[model samples]
Target: MLWKVFMHHSSMIFLGLCSGSGVFYSLACLKTGSCYFIEWELISINSCCVSMTLILDWMSLMFLGFVSFISSMVLYYSGEYMSGDENMNRFMYLVLGFVMSMWFLIISPNLISILLGWDGLGLVSYALVIYYQNEKSSAAGMLTALSNRIGDVAILIGISMMFIYGGWNFLFYVGDMKDSINKEILTGLVVLAAMTKSAQIPFSAWLPAAMAAPTPVSALVHSSTLVTAGVYLLIRFSPALESTISQSILLLLSGLTMFMAGLGANFEYDLKKIIALSTLSQLGVMVSILALGFSDLAFFHLLSHALFKALLFMCAGTIIHSVKEFQDIRAMGSLIYQMPLVGIFMNLANLALCGAPFLAGFYSKDMILEVAFMSSINFISFMLYFLATGLTVCYTLRLIYYSLSGDFNLGSLFNVGGEAKIMVNPMFGLGLGAIFGGAFLSWIIFPQPYMICMSMGFKTLALSVSILGGLTGYLLNMGSVNYSLNSLYFHKMTVFSGSMWFMPFLSTFGVSKLFLQSGMKYQGIGDMGWSEYYGGQGIYYMISSWSSKLQILQDSSLKVYMLSFLLWLMVLFFLVL
Candidate 1:
């Protein structure tokens, strides 16, 4: 009966679950006294605890507060966002599942629990991605699942290594096992996993592919759930990452990813894909900052990015809905007049994303650059930093320009107006947060001394450089002559080369085709080949082949089945031993 009711009214059930669970979480946080003992639970001989260190600490509190607040707002927004859609209930269930999984992830005390929540979130996200049940959505879902599976395998291997070399008890605190684990090997594995999860370099393709998901899913994933998981892992295990070569690799990969994604966003014509790429770039920046061992700064940036990115994605959804499901920015012109509320919120969010002073992104992003400068005096780091900053400016400006800046071109279009109250309400809430949340949280998160360390003159210089880059991009869009050729080439070259079209033919075609052919060749060598050879022709051939195989198998089944089961058990026992 419960299952039937839930299936029938999944949306209401999910919303109720979210609200109830959130209340429980808040109560647990408030009642729990210490970082390690909060929400203590015992399962058989194993004990588990929720880490409240971040919750009690100022920095973690700010992020937690923002996560909770934004989650609530998005839920409210979803009430209307998916209104009247056939799968609204299913979408709500997935959203609730994602939020709960993220909550668990943030408070996870041990690596095991973290992995649980991590994979749980991935599972929910896969469902959300394919919610529309279209060919594109299905493909995107498969890509996301495959990419996350690769990352999961790496994480599992790393965990196994840690348990083997380090003590089992050390799983609760990665910092404790840092000295025991082989730094080089463990770091390499962890970095591989993190890079895959964060969509760095080659793994970055999955993020853009995920744009086929609903707008709300995109907003949630980009803002605070999926992409942020990698950074969250790094921040949680900062002590271990900092001591290993992983930190340096993270810096290199993140810097490259930021620059590449930023460039890609600049050239992207799809509105959602642009935001998706922008999320990748922004996540890269966060990862880079965390790689520098500035946990507070990274968390700060995470908070800010979540607010503005969510607002931006929601606004994009609103615009698409307003124009009757059109997402091509090239097709969209000045929508500001049609959807004034969306335009205002989107513009504010864009300003914050561009790192305008006093906004959320500005303070956090500036702090990241400051930490990078302080940590590295190398010319390469400086060059990478400069390139990433410039790309950030160009892409952000491009997003603003192509969508909101042009003349009102209703190009063969019809009705346009403000979004549903559900969508606009969330946008309004996120815009307010983007505008002032960073400033409010800065004091608590940064404190006095840390703020002083981050407020150095060189940090100011970096901010100026980033701002100048943004201004230059903005001016050039407006047909200014003062743009530097060096900057132009840097922006264009990076953007052009980062595209899927620029992928090596060997990578896209030769290797993929080779793999497919190898699989077919292997099937031909096996008894499975008989079915493949006959199945495509007609039902008669398929039935004949199947009947022959069934008869042959049945003739030997008893002995074969017994032997196979014994062999499998022996192998399993051997492995356990």
Candidate 2:
């Protein structure tokens, strides 16, 4: 009956095929270097032509391997997680479609081909976000799609401009174009596109809102495919942005995003949202580094962040599933005692996120902070970087203290226990990657020598942000005086931070509320009153009046016509006399 209801074998087989292709292609890239080919010719009217292309290089190859591997693990994990769902087949198919789109995105270098993947991500992710078919899911999905549509439009504009270069293959021109007005335009468009996809600053409301989807989708979308697409595009196109105004804007926006996400995560209580905020923060780090002319480092951090963030999401899914409907930290406490394995994995991920010692996050995050410091940036960027680092540790420690070790406030009736093999197995695979992914990728990805020279001030601050934020987070949460409410006494600040500085408001109702009210006012004055009365009612009344007058004239047509003619003749004779 289960087999009839859900097609597991086919899904598993697809996953295996992807995973095998990824591993094989990654190895092949190491030996053969970058490869590109036109998959098919779509259109060739006159001199313009569009073709599907697959580009394989060390960069695409390795990222594809990682994405495919994670998707496989996630698919495996979902088998047990979604076993009870009524539409398991639908969910699986959506995920498969999502993965296929991601694959097309990974291998493409042309602007037109990339659109196929980029738009697919936005559309498929919307479907996945609304998979639950609830009000919350529907709202989140719309926000996700609309926000992404901004990037989609940006790419479309960029594609139109590509006619200047006589090719739609952006990968060729992005790195090779010399300084010119047209090149700068291309660079600006690329940056705009990247910012939206990566959820940077103004476009950030969608990432956290997207937590409405199932956890596995979050793990995949947030960690590897959707969000990282922007970062990868930037990394590939970093050369176009070098020494341009676009790069400076990127630095500023990324720094702000880092600060906002870090602050929001510290204030957030929802389990999934906190992790989602962390992903946003890490994306900022990636973008910031890329803006500073460290594409390799950015790519490195991207990989490391993906490994641990995925694991972290999976662990969060485990917690949510075990506890049923409760996701608030206040409702969850002393979870380590009931489910030690999941707890261990969760803490491990949190530690890695905070860049503890040698975990996957540490390798890339440490290098990123160091490189950021060495660069001569404005004071604002400087503060945002270090403060964001501190804020990250602050919230992660808060997470552990509140959820892992605090009092068990979730009522006694709910039974919390270990997860089944189907759930736990995928976690272990990713956990192994989380633990060693950073160290391994650091060596593998950066074969060439990467160096940074920083003064003592930068180094000291870099080290201190983590230590101080960690200690303060732990003590603040642990102290008996610091209970949930009325403890901090800074109500305004808490409200600001907790409400994501009203970003969700600013992104959603904040922007629309004023316009919507203005629309209503215009409707009342223009459409309902003047336009309706004048255009519709007034026109009708004029037509009716004319019709009545004409009818009267028609009824007395013979008499009226003779009287009018006689009156006109008399007037003419008087004028002549």
Candidate 3:
């Protein structure tokens, strides 16, 4: 029993090791700046030595530390949350594997070695997503896996193209690569890979659906580590990608994704999925800022967002698990009365997410918007940026009203409970971080403050949007209570917003249905029809029929053979003449 107890907390032990590594490496990085490289020569490839390169820059070390800290807290919480499962050991191992993969990804600068971590994250996450082994989990796992495969393939293609640089190491030649057609292709491919991983725009359908995973998985992977991988990759490579057409495309798509996800979250009711969409929205913001050429700002936001978003997911998971697994907002109300911690942490996480001043999100999110206002960006991106910022506050308040502050609406069987130390302990660490992480990262990332030479009106734009959006969200949520307005009156609008503008449909059955029908038509008309008949089988049949006649003539008798030969010779002679 004693040994079993130790094994039960094995996840936390691994976290300790990682935490130590992060501390040692972070201090080392501070002393060395960004010049630390751990290169191990692997087997030579075509006379060029292929080596594994691990970069111990402040970025990698700090991110690894953050990842480790979050994972540690999550694992501590998982002890009670997953205590009953017979496969609890498997869950622990998978989560640790995910952390290991993420660390590998963080340290490696070489694309080849990074793939080891990249693919490992993809694989382990798939396993974690489908850990529950139900229909929903299966389908969600497939969507997440297949959506990410495009990025993996793009990276492989980029690797093949990297031979043009005469090396597999892209970190060395990132900014030095000349802008040419080949470079453009390489740039586009890398950005596409990042967008796919980051859940930007068209590739975003997988993030919300990925909430089919367990709540712990949501807190660990979707909210923090895995989804942010793409943004981090882009930030690392931004020097090479800035001012290119690829970044331009990212600018447009990320803006759209930011707006789309915020709108979707406002209308969503599923607690975990709402948080999932929020993660996607934040990802869009990071990518947008990255494309705008403030990658350090983007990286700062990434770290800050990870802190709060993971906490948000943990709170969401607590709520969902506490209420007998009822995750729908319509099914929960006045939860603060019974579960004060959930409500408090939920509100704090949401506040941080809304970019409340002095909180983590404010430091980075505010900086991003102020920079955008200062930059020479187009009107559409500008509008999208501010609108999405407002929408973030809107959805967060709407979530508060539905779940935390409203009158009790849950079923009689529901019990608002999070009493276990295992479940509640993690929220404390994350809660503190959610409140301070953004500010901490800003000071570290930007030792020198930004000098924005903009009008006060432009400077206050982000705060104004946040405030107004919060008030509007409060009014909109409470309006139904005051006047008892029927949602059916705005049925079309609600449906559009709630369904994420039919993005899920458009990404799923919309695309699947169209492909299925198109495939049938192609198969019937082309593969099974004229092409097959005329290209292969039809020619064979035609030649076979002719050959039977020729064989009969040739083998029938000596006279027939002689006649055939004579005709052939005559035809040949005539052609020659």
- TM-scores, one per candidate: 0.79, 0.90, 0.89
Candidate with the larger TM-score of 1 and 2: 2
List ranges where model 2 is wrong by over 4 Å.
4-6, 454-461, 480-488, 519-577
Model 1 TM-score on a 0 to 1 scale = 0.79
Writing each residue's lDDT as its tens digit, candidate 1 over 1-577 gives: 3443344244444544554454455445535632433433334222333222212333334345556666666666666667667666667677878877877677664555567777987798889888888998897787788778888888778766656543322334566554544766776776777777788876887788888888878888889878888777777667767667677877787877887777677667799988888888888888887877787688778888899989988888878877768898767777777788888888888878878888988888876776677775368767777777777777677667666776455567478884677577667777888988788657645557453464456757766766777876666655522234444567656545557335324333554688878887877765366665556545677788899978876887788789879999999999999
lDDT-better candidate, 2 vs 3 = 2
Q: Highest lDDT: give the candidate number.
A: 2
Q: After best superposition, candidate 3 residue 436: deviation in angstroms?
A: 2.3
Give Cα-based local distance difference scores for all models.
0.71, 0.86, 0.84
C-alpha lDDT of candidate 1 relative to the true structure: 0.71
Pick the winner on TM-score between candidates 1 and 3. 3
- Arrange candidates, best lDDT first: 2, 3, 1
Looking at model 1, the pairs that clash are none
